[model samples]
Target: MKYLADVTTIEYNADKCTGCGRCIEVCPHGVFDMNGKKAFITDKDLCMECGACANNCEFEAISVDYGVGCAAAVINSMISGGEPACGCSGDDGGSSSGACC
Candidate 1:
């Protein structure tokens, strides 16, 4: 689920984290981890550009611009100047409407 580093906009401020585990709980990709009582990014590459963690963080520890899932195939493809091949066209990653894929 990794995208170009420049295109993904995940910004995490550990100093602002409260270790409430909200990010860890809401992230579809296990992007956050617990270290003592603070939350930290486990792998920035695993992020799908979904804004769940940012939207859920009450402490303002996380912030991100959204995109890069099956949902962004069309947009990302255009940016890369290629045919839509995000591996999302034919399959729904999981939603009944084929939205996840």
Candidate 2:
């Protein structure tokens, strides 16, 4: 499937990573692999575009643009005439008002 560019891709900063393995633990897609002590993006294409790795990273080493990758979610939101929470709006879904639709 061709994913939209709105989905956040994972970017790794080698200098900031501390080999903590937290990102690996939280990722559902096995997008990362441990190289010695630090993490590397071994399978970027297999990524589900989830932000779990970025969220769990304490050192800010990993960055991703996360949002709902589900077509059903987008279609449903549109049908209902409401904005979706797909994270593609450049919002992290961390707001109290939940305005990231």
Candidate 3:
């Protein structure tokens, strides 16, 4: 399912990307694709803001505004004026309790 359609906070800098495909390899949501020798964000809306692509990018080409993926968290973040932190534990976007959902 679409996690946050039209609202992904992930940013990709092609100039910084080494085209090593690490982000593509690490992203669990298929949010990126190859664009010649660099990486392209093919589906930004599908992103869960989990930070997996950002953490895995050695060149620091990827950056994500991490968030706890829910409507309450979004409202809370707005009220608190703080960035949301997706509580994903790893590249697989699993919860801390080891659940995918």
Residue 65, candidate 3: alpha-carbon lDDT: 78
- Deviation of model 3 at 15, angstroms: 0.5
| Per-residue alpha-carbon lDDT of candidate 2 for residues 17-53, written as tens digits (9 for 90 to 100) | 9999998898876778899988898767767767888
Of candidate 2, the 10-residue stretch with the lowest lDDT total is 88-97
Candidates' C-alpha lDDT = 0.75, 0.71, 0.74
Per-model TM-score, in order, reads 0.64, 0.66, 0.68
- Name the runs in model 1 displaced over 4 angstroms: 1-7, 68-101
Please report how far candidate 2 places residue 67 from its true position, in Å. Answer: 0.9
Q: Write the per-residue lDDT of candidate 1 for residues 6-92, one digit (tens) a residue.
A: 556899998998889999899988989999999988888888877999888888888997754554656656665544444544465
lDDT for predicted candidate 3 compared with the true structure? 0.74
Separate clash counts for every candidate:
3, 3, 3
Candidate 2 residue runs with Cα over 4 Å from true position: 1-8, 75-83, 86-101
* lDDT tens readout by residue for model 3, 1-101: 88546777788889998899988788888999998999998878888877888888999888987756765445545655655434444565423331333
TM-score of 1: 0.64
